[model samples]
Target: MKKYKDFVCVGFAFALSTVSCEAKNDAKIHVSQLGYTPNSDKKAMVVPDGKVDSFYLCDAASGKICYRGKLSPKKYWDLSGEDLQWADFSSYDKSGEYYLSVGGKKSYNFTISSKAYDDLTLWAHKTFYLWRCGIDCTEEFSNFHGQSYAHKAGHPDVNVIVHPSAESAGRKAGSTVKSPGGWYDAGDYGKYTVNSAIALESMLMSAEAFPSFYKNFDMEIPESTNNTVDVLDEAMYNLEWMLTLIDTVDGCVAHKVTTKRFVPMVLPAETNVQRYMIGKSTATNYGFAAIMAKASRLYKNNPDYPDFSEKAMRYAKRAYEWAEKNPGIIFHNPDSIGTGSYTARFPEQFRFWADVELYLATKDKKYIDLTAIDTFQYDVPTWQLPASFALMSLIVGVENNMVDGDLKKKTELHFDKLANLLYDRMEKDPGRFPLFKFEWGSNGGLANAGTILLLQYKKTGDKKYLKAAQDITTYMIGRNATGYCFVTGFGQKSPMFIHDRRSTGDGIAVPVPGLLAGGPTLDAIRDCDTYVYNYDHPKSEYPTREYPARAYNDEICSYSTNEVAINWSAPFLMLLAGINENSK
Candidate 1:
């Protein structure tokens, strides 16, 4: 397994020359890589350090100024810790290739078209195949990363070994169990149940929210040839693996499957390392139940997969029962394990999600009564807290007249409050972005926030909520402090060295498309020591000021800033789906 210490020397080697002068100049004016929809409000970010007082939109080919505008009044951004201004181009509705010019510097070329995000939506869905595990990623399917025939030597995981890092009650070393097939969790090779559950829920919700959009959409995965909805087919590839985590004998589920240490950045086929099933916990079991219950409904009417719904419901019921019996169990990674902890201190949200989903699936009053629906707070769903999954399910139930009137009214009130709060916050923010806290995976947080706002737009028919959601997507592409598209292969100046093991080692010039990087971390808590020792050349090499949002670096060595994860990409897909649906 790889250690953090191994990268110290490598970090030092690249630190001095990583941030180029060109990037510094480009940071002055940041515009979206995908540009703006023809009729939507368009905006660009102008850093405080820049001297530009006004901006102009010029044709990319002709270099003729089409429109000019003054910068918005400066407002302090809590996340970026900087006073930033915006250049609004909302009135420019002509469809053309254009660039933003502030002072004498020209921003990256972008497009203003009706179908701005059409290709992006397809590419985002294809990203899942790139992150797939348990199979070879052939050149035919992968444009970058070439071909990696991985895990050929590995067995079916029919008898999972319990490593010392995962010792627990009813689980001993060399214990035989069946657990197999799932997508790799992140830049690493670990397969985490908590993260997988959230990603699956995102896909499921995307399907539920925009059935017509994803119904005939082609993901171009191996299962696309099958007579089934491509979105559900892609989700099933991961769901099948998640099913293996369930210990049918006892109804508990393993938290994750990983080696004892972080593996080196190598092709999956070359690693050939032994993997183990880690500790079992109520959180994992309940999350599994919630996702499976949702899956049961999604696949219930599918003619291609006849038994999928029944099997999912049976497993969900069993897992929910087990969680009820062991409600407080939390899996803390043993000291020996050096992978992601994915620990959840509170499992109530997980329980609530499972109950609501099960009720939706079975229409059982018992499940609804157990949900305690009114007490639960609605928020954007994350791996740690998944109350949004329950909220989403309930919203769907109310729409279908499956939920009680009193509970439906309460849920609607919560949605109204959240929607208004998010819209008001976005209106007040200098950049019109809806986030206040900039942490690891902050890009994902922004995307999830957009999902929440879009949900409210559906419930309330508010265009402001929809516009706020679109603003979050714009912020991600290039309208932020870093001035680079956080996704790997989209923008003119996008991430090239994201902290994905395969992308780093695959000998590919470009990383996979649509993989969202964990954006700026304000405190620099995880990678500060390495940065200080290696990149703090004369204290001026790195960005001098400690701005909350400006803390991002696009280097591969900066894992805190540029690591790509499934959880991040999932919500991004949701945001994309929302945009696509609304655009049409």
Candidate 2:
């Protein structure tokens, strides 16, 4: 055969353009509950033990009542008007769990599980529902995706997978951008890899997690059934096709899948640059393989869709092997994490939805430990860093089936402290905390907050988690923008923990500005209380594109499966499933 590898090397520029490794100093910031923030996690001052009168949350910083709600002396009491002593809601306890206020019954008695805020669980449910409803977010995204795409229970944003920018411009550019900068379907910004992989897995997860929906196609192939299977099918096709372009290139996804649109473009996989194809870019390809492996593991005897599991596993293994060898930038390692451009150490831990499937399929210890987060970091005498990876590490310990007993305890405590702190921030200022706090935005940020809270709830089974989830959902649904959330700023800096060490002493990571993805946020809020969204969020005066429109950031067009597939569509599908299942 004429050397196929020769064509790739000649056709593409097979080199990476990494950001200069000039030592970028990490930012020094103060957050309480990094276990022992000297000024942070101190207990709130209280009245004399014998006294019983006013019930309220007193903020130590301001020495004022942050919030006041009636309480009962009982472990779980009724919401009686006469009751006055209320337990203060704080992340100090646990998160992702919540309770409903039942009249004269249980105060904190209404328990929502830690998984109440789970991204995978809730979004999977929503995406399934959207699939059932027949108008997926991807269809809506096409309005911003530049080119139109067919939509039926879809991960609609799929068609534009490699497209650079889904341009939304002029005064119509609306929010999600700074000064309504020229919108390029190829050039706005976002977190591509992790979020997209999660979304991608959600597609398979719908089929696997709730076989009734995805696998149901085998039985009740409806006349108009174009579920995410189509989406994934196409994704696989495009993915395999894209491999042609990647043979020599170090790290980069094609500009777009459309034959015409991105025929001549490819860029380095920089943060906020090339379409967001983070760890999942490679991880997704592998994850798909893993999914197939899972299907194979399950369907080995079933002859119908026989090879899916096997093929999927093979693909996953190959991808993993490639990642180990290439080590392309992302959560592959911790040292490079704050370095930006996507990095997470030991993400295999905490049962990341993707890793979880593979672990479930193979029952591999290594994969489970992929979910393992390092508690050893806790022993290091340093500032408490609570990045997503750290959270994963904490989760690993809490869920540890294997590991030294002491390490497990230490891990659980670490998570406890983190959860407690997050809870406090949520209660204190659910709006401002978490930078990616529970709010309106296209970044699927609220979904992130919701998921994190749900993670906490699952861990501790504490009522505070339910409260956090409830509060976030309450705030979100109360705003009701027809499931669309908006914010300002896309191009300030990577939303991850590290701040820029810009040589110019003045220009730090400037915050850009606004739009929201309808899928993820709605799914997240729905996880807590579906009743919250009686009134939907309106279509923005400006277009849905340009969400979190940061001034200086570049856009990562189609590679962002988070915005397109998983976060956007999976939630709808999942929600639909929950609705139908319950209604049935």
Per residue, candidate 2 scores C-alpha lDDT tens digits across 1-584 of 11111111012343111111111111110111111111111111111133343233222222222233333342211111111222333322222222211221111211123332232223233222222211232444322113322233311222122222212111111112111111111112222333334443334333433344444432111221443343344223222322322212222221121122122121111112222121233433333333334444444543443454455455555545544553432333223222123233332321233344455567675654522444333211101122343334335434545333554665566666655665666455312233232122333444445444545665666645644544444222211212112111211122211111110111223211111233222222222222111112221122123222211111211122112223433333433333222212
lDDT of each: 0.75, 0.30
Q: Lowest-lDDT window of 10 residues in candidate 2?
A: 28-37
Residue 223, candidate 1: C-alpha displacement in angstroms: 1.1
Error of 1 at 559 (Å): 2.2
Residue 32 in candidate 2, Cα distance off native in Å = 30
lDDT of 1: 0.75
What tens-digit string does per-residue lDDT give for candidate 1 at 264-308?
Answer: 877676676677888778888899999999999989878888988
* Best by the lDDT measure: 1
Which residue segments of model 1 deviate by more than 4 Å?
1-25, 48-53, 144-159, 164-172, 526-545
lDDT of 2 at 454: 49
